[model samples]
Target: MESQKGKWWKKAVVYQVYPASFKDSNGDGTGDIPGITSKLDYLHSLGIDVLWICPMYESPQIDLGYDISNFEDIHRPYGTLQDMQDLIDGCHERSMRIIIDLVINHTSELHQWFQESKASKDNDKRDWYIWRQAKYDDQGIRKPPNNWRSIFGGSAWTWDEATEEYYLHLFTPKQPDLNWENEAARRAIYASSMEFWLKRGVDGFRIDAVNMYSKPPSHPDAPITNPSMEFQWAETLYCNGPRMHEFLSEMNEVMSSYGEIMTVGELPHTPDRSEVLSYVSAAKKQMNMVFQFDVVCIGYGKDPKFDVVPHDWRLSELKKAVENTQGLIMGTDAWTTSFLENHDQGRSISRFASDKPENRVQAGKMLALMNATLSGTLFVYQGQEIGMVNMPQSWGIEEYKDIESKNFYEEVVKTSKGDSKALEKAKRGLQYLARDHARVPMCWDSSPQGGFSTSTDTWMRVHDLYDQINVADQEKDQSSVLSFWKTALKLRKEWASLLIYGDFELFDLEDEHCFVYAKRSDCNVALVVLNFTKKERDWKAPKEFNGKSFTLLTSTYSGDGKPGELRPYEGRLYVQV
Candidate 1:
């Protein structure tokens, strides 16, 4: 493992905030930077080391803030550049680092660079983006240059009448992919975007869809994976492509210029273990860590995430994913990121465990223990600490605001052709997999609109159970989910040696509904035992662990250091005494 002598990030807890849903200080029914600044105390109280704000750049709102129109400016609705500076200063004053999303994989079609590239055949920025001539079919009809499919749905190629060319867009048409092959484009992004933020005192960046930056040189048509598919496969061609490491290394040179900064890339496809290690290896000096999708893909059905599907996961699947990831980087200089949910995925309590009223707290604590204690940088998304559940199933298709979710719903309904079961499946998929499930406003209190905003017309509807799950209720109770998170974070920082730099091993992989693991460092050992189910299960201390005297570090139950039968959904941490 990389030396943990001065790397604060090795033991840091990062809190991810979807700026649009965090808070709104102006009562404009939309969250803003000032609103986030106002909540600094609340965040610091939770003992987080860094705050990871989602994209706030200028955009057309096609994919929330993911589609950047202006790299250096802030989105109008999010507030002015001054507001961002204030937010940064506020965080620094509180000794909390702030990292914003760096979404350079693609830019909105409305972006000036893209507009100029599509304006004419020989514009100055013509090569800035990937554009190609359309091929004519036997019937004299125009077809895309290649058979690449968009991640959102349909063809990845979009035709431009003015230029008589098809531009590449791996996501929605508005998000046209950038050509990283152009050295000028890469340098321009570094000068105009990344350096601008680093100069503003922002600690680091969470690169969005980082693996899609490089595309193949040949630009050949993707192979047909399924005979009856509407579009061909493209992820294999573009993701982790030939020149990805080269581009990242060039970018890393700039990051290294800064004294102390963190960078974590969000890699979509499951990359080979050695390939992943190269990205974050201390010798490579590329990225500090990466967020791979293997663990999160357990609940994804037979297909990719764009296909609407309900939760279909086994506890063993999660264990395998976690184990494989841990095994790859156990004694290596490379590092990994651990997170159960993000802006693209649903809540963990709802997706991984039973979120009924009686089991919410226990389930939330159990999931927290599972991720927070592992050897990685832990990321806690907004509302995750408070045990938030998925949105009500009564929400209809119209209630959904996410473009990807809505597009999936239309695709399923159209293909189903009035099949009742397919329609029901789509509804369940939305409930379990929709990005909107994590986009709901953070419930700060039981006030109108859950204290997210004074306006009743918030951007997204507040969770219906806000009254019982709000921060106000949790703050008063010592056994609340929020309290457990605070305690967990406190213990993690206090025992950094055992949790951060220790050796990891699964305690009992054979346990049906319980996940047990141990962290050993030198002569000290820390055991983490968790029950993923709602019903109480009999668990005996393993033979090797039974002989040693132990001290309880933390638990979901109300007991002290006493060892006995674990309750339902209980999680206990024990340290050798």
Candidate 2:
């Protein structure tokens, strides 16, 4: 077995907190750092070792906190610097580590650096961000530098009248991509932004879009994927560019200077395991692990970013995604991450499991079981433990607050020319795939405010199902998803050697209804069986373990149902006896 000795993170389970939606402290309708500090005990109770808080840096909120304006300080709505320190202290006091999000790939246009960079052609900070001359047509009409499309849609190069140049923005025009090639800019990002937080006692960071740091050597028109759309998805042209590795390694050096810090990169829409390992392998010294997009992007239709016609991800494909990812860094010094939901994607309960009233609880527990058994470090997004689902039907397109969702919907509107049916279809697409589904306020109870804030309303609307699905309500029922999560985590901690670093052996790969696997440590083996479908499934153990006796460690159901039968969305964990 791989010796993951003394590595706290190898055995640690992470609970991600989306600050604005976690809990509101001062009743200002926004969850803040103080609010996170207030819940330290609750996180400890959930048995998580790390609390990974999303971006809380100063910003215009154009793309939420991802477009950081002042990384050195905290955002006003989030809290002051002292409050952030107190939060770090509180988590440490509870024996839990704290890791804040790092989002330096881009900066808010309102940022001091960007403001100066765009002020004139001769500004010292002009080269800190990407800037290019505008193209001209035969008629002498101005055009963007290339046909590159922003991840948020529209032209990647926004014409900047102030500087008489076009600036690159992989996202919104308000978020200008940083020129990592600039030595001074890289230095400032490390010393002023990264070290400032590390010196203040943050354990590490969940690096935001680390793979997007380097841009293509030259921007050229990409082949049209959507003929009707002018700008095309130029991800292949820019993602994992030539300098991507060099940049991440440089960033890793800064992180390593702070000692055994934990870092997990966000590698969106990349499923190449070999390429991912190059970033996480200890020899490479880039990251501890990375969040792979293969599993979560399974159901995406045409465009992986915004799929208008989403598919219901199948069990067989999902099983392969998990197994393939686990094999990425198995014996190597690198590791992968196990997660189904995050601030970027919709909830696992809605997408991976059934959210129907009769099945939600069981499905939630089953997913927990599946994640806890994976070889990588486990991460649970906020509201996932309690099975919070997608936004309800009553929510119109106007209710969606995510910039990406709104922009994508607007694109659809423009293409359909205000057709009612097309508009509704677009809204439904967003409902299934929007980030707001995961960004909704955490439901603490059945209160009108969903127990998130003292105010009557929140920054974003709380999921209306909060009354039916909440922490307080689930806490009362021992069979609840929350209780099962605690149980699963406790068991995982107890059997870390077998569950975390054991050899992963998958079974029944072609059995579309069931995902079966075993974690083996020498002669000791732990088996996991999950029924992905709603109907009951008759499962047969692999022949290699046919005669072995096993003890049930934890399960989604109250009763041990028939030995060979698994009820809809049921999960079972067992250790060889």
Q: Write the per-residue lDDT of candidate 2 for residues 115-148, one digit (tens) a residue.
A: 9999999999999999999889999999898999
Query: Could you give candidate 1's per-residue lDDT for residues 234-339 as a string of tens digits?
Result: 8889898889999989988887777688898998775589878878888887888999887877777655454454555678778878877776667787777778
- The number of residue pairs in model 1 that clash at the backbone is 0
lDDT of 1 at 481: 92
Which pairs of residues collide in candidate 1? none
Query: For candidate 1, what is the TM-score?
Result: 0.97
Q: Assess the local accuracy of residue 566 in candidate 1 as a C-alpha lDDT between 0 and 100.
A: 70
The candidate 2 region of ten consecutive residues with least summed lDDT is 304-313
For each candidate in the order shown, give its overall lDDT on alpha carbons: 0.85, 0.86
Model 1 regions more than 4 Å off:
304-311, 560-564
lDDT of 2 at 203: 91
